[model samples]
Target: MSVDSDPDMFSSQTTVASNWSKDERSQKDTFNWAMEMMSHGQYLPLKSQASLNLEDLQYSTKMYYIRQARLACEIVCESIAPSQGIELLTQVYQSMKLKTAETKKKDAVTDTIISAYKKAEDYTTKVQILSLIVEKYSKSELLSFIEGLTIYKIDAARKYASTHGPGQYVTPPKITRLRLSKQKIHHFIEFISAPCYLQVVGFGSRHLKLSSGLTVKVPKVIRTMIASRLITAYNNYCKDNTILPPCRATQYKIIKACAASQLKSLHGLDNYISDGMESIDTLKKVVSNLGTKGLQTSKVSDLIQSLDTLKLHLKNEFRSHLSTESDCSQHCMHFALSEKGCEHTHSNICQPCDRMYQIRDEIQNVMTSNFSNIEIQEKEELEHDILVSTEKNLGLEGSFY
Candidate 1:
């Protein structure tokens, strides 16, 4: 299982008091539970405790992973990273039968240890025993090595044998300041109030009533940012002024703190959402009136499916027949079929196709007229934008977008 990436956060992972059973519990069990709580950057832990099972060896009402984690670290002597140490402890967990949580039964690792012990008895003579298992000095010494495999005593012994020293580049990288000065930050606050970034809250005269009984109006962040757009603007400004910009995270934190309670961004999807509702409402009105004597009864799904099929079919259709030349077989396919089109003048005009094209165009015109009515809304929104730039300063005029 993956361990927490930022080990420093929970560095002091000392456990609260618990019974001796806590000491017997293996590191693997505790690590898995801790992993479940670590969700990316948000460190939210679930309150669900593992209920007691009578078959458990280290049986306790409450088992804290904090305590188990500390013990695992101590066993590894801090030589390994906590993640590496967890892997080493897993071998310990598998071999030590007493260390197994509920099983009291021996596992494969434990069985391997037992077999190695029985095999050691045959290595009775000192020199023969040395030859049998790759030239070890004594049978008793060899057996100790085999048993130490379970508890990782061998690893503990070799900890300093491979100790790493500081690298050649000991000096820290020289730091050039990138933090926005008080004036720049103040300029940033003013820059963001520009027409492109923010607008007045469109609530008109209406005031937001709080639980504290305070009434206030909020501003609309014009774009779905203090987003990429805001950052890009900041970087551009810094570049033009021949100064380095602070990191994105730093800028984000500063802006987020400023807008925490009062500002809300106007989402890009908002227009589509309103348009979608209007389209759905129009379709519903058409469907609802179907029962009246003049109208045909049909589902919205059926209409949509048929429309999709017709659109594909119409696009693929060739107006080869409309070509003026009688021998224009190759050139027929080249004719761009629409209300009007033919590289070759019409040898024969298609009345039926012409009528169909006219009807299609008419339907398109009607749909476009209905949908494109949002031009006024768009103009109004643009008017609401706070137009503030080096060249143009149209100070905060309208309420919101």
Candidate 2:
């Protein structure tokens, strides 16, 4: 019988049915009580509070309480139809009793839900609730929830690597070949932001499986960015410069700054060069048939050619040389004046410019060139004027003698 259709047993006591057949009564009683209690309207705030406060509990007990709470929630979810599940769950959840504690209330309840989610056997159910919980919690809480799930440990590791670098993490030593088969480049753009994807960027196995199930070969342009960041951070902070890795959260900032200009140009080049691999008409047909069982195949030369052009453009951009001083100031010109001064100017790179400058160079160094060898010529006219001014020695050297 449908849970909602059983109206004969209305009283709280009758819902347990003492005289009915044992098995039948047990099933009815359990289902009825579960439905009633689960539907109780007073526990929503309590359950939410419990999830918040669960984190501070001892690990073992914390795990137990969260499991019970999750089981209770899941049973309600599974037993009810999706159409009414949320409404009923919300109602019953309101009546549940919660352990009330002021301190760490938020963390405790979050911990409870996260622990329960970890032990949940139903993948679909787990994913659904976990996504909800993540959306509800703060970043720190969300990360905590992630830490509880073994599956997302990879993401955690990648986040650490982005800050601490690959050497600190157990990353593959190198990345050689790149395969780019995914239809959309937008996925790669998003991947760059994810911790797990960034971790495996330059080095290691060719095949990568994203949590979302879209697997693709790491393209060369992407790998270079990964390698450049890690290797530079390693060399500078770990050894040569003897400093901590660049400020936390700034690695991707560097990557984005370096890649932005390139992505724009790449779009233009792809639109221009991809004409021959397949006709536009055939290419359009294949795109329309993507992800279907009866899809047909064509040369796709036009599409592939466009993709290649994009890839090449990205490669060039990733490996593009940064010009240190594009517009030389008069001071720089003065510095570049004589052969000796010119050599000095060339050898002594502006600190800020050189730092990001070197990073860009290493990534694109594979087939790229360095900045043109020019002395920073200083404005002698200005310098001579300063020397000739009568107000030059404004300070007194006097009385000590």
Candidate 3:
């Protein structure tokens, strides 16, 4: 007969059966009370009552109830008193069963970690949890967690800074710095020993200064100096390793390609040169006008001096190219004469040589003497025009007055 039909037999079964019955009833009562408290938003009282009943509960049952109470308290704390809820959860976590299901244990651990992370007031606790995670978790998991934490902290900081306004100084929480340092260390360890160490070093050194400027509250001058030093060090490393060393020919080719792309036709060379000269003329006129108006001349003087230097450079380049082209033509002519078996002495100039020499002389005259005289004359004429215009303007203004 079934136990239900045999009441006498059930009663005589054993103390173990009776004890099991009592324990089951107690667990049901505790679960019902906890649920009722949670429904009524009595989270603090529920936590206390749950802790009291934990001693009476079986290990498995105790863990399940603790999880439920922790979740309820978290919701309450988030809406009302976060610190109190977190404190309650911490207590429940302490009492959690270690022998629980793997998934449940992981969930409990995660919840605890999250609680630790949210405790900004206690940076030490957060740092401890972060270190523990890094030490225990797989690299991929650690990286994922760190990345999320970094993004969250940065976003929170930005929001706080914006709300506080510019004049108000906002410093990052200590926990954030600790996490970032840990993350950087982890990244360095992971990448620095790899085959692509050079690439890693190149990237890190380049961005380290930028990251510091954006994330840290350092002065602009200091940041710039730090960045310069880092770049210099990276360049030195590249030089030492002969990794992608600079080639002057490659640089020249790149520059030539860029220039060629911008230039539509070789015939526009003279036009471009003339445009540059006209720009200089306009600058001179502006300076003269500024002087006539009795404005600042220091800036104008600096500009005029720079322009003179630029003009000198242009003249030098033109002279060098003229000399090079003339020498090239002479060499070609000489080669042709030798190939023809005509042994012409240097003193005995051929027709081609004579014409080339005359052309070279003309170029030399233009580069060395004619250009300088023309520039002097133009400057004098410009000065005269400026004085005349200034006098005319003064006369007109005087007549109006």
- Overall lDDT per candidate, in order of appearance: 0.41, 0.40, 0.42
**Residue lDDT tens for model 3, 1-401:** 68899888877777778787777766546755655565574443333344455688889778877776566667655556554767765665666633232223245676576566666466334444454344344444444544446644433434444565422444656662212354433432332222211111112222223434663322211111122222343345456457543333433332332211122232333344344444445545645554554435775575456545544333222212121112343333334333454343433333432342343233234334423544566546645644443343223222211
TM-score of 3: 0.21
Q: What is the lDDT of residue 313 in candidate 1?
A: 24
TM-score of each: 0.22, 0.14, 0.21
Clash pairs, model 1 backbone: 195-386, 200-399, 323-347, 324-346, 324-347
Summed backbone clashes in each candidate are 5, 41, 0
Assess the local accuracy of residue 69 in candidate 3 as a C-alpha lDDT between 0 and 100. 58
Go through the candidates in order and give the C-alpha RMSD of each one to the true structure.
30.5, 28.6, 24.4
Clashes of 3: 0
Which has the better lDDT: candidate 2, or candidate 3? Answer: 3
Which stretches of model 1 miss by more than 4 angstroms? 1-163, 166-179, 194-226, 236-249, 261-401
Supply candidate 1's per-residue lDDT for 275: 37
Tens digit per residue, CA lDDT, model 1, 374-396: 45664344223211110121010
- What value of lDDT does candidate 1 attain over all alpha carbons? 0.41
Off by over 4 Å in 3: 1-34, 37-88, 94-279, 282-316, 322-401
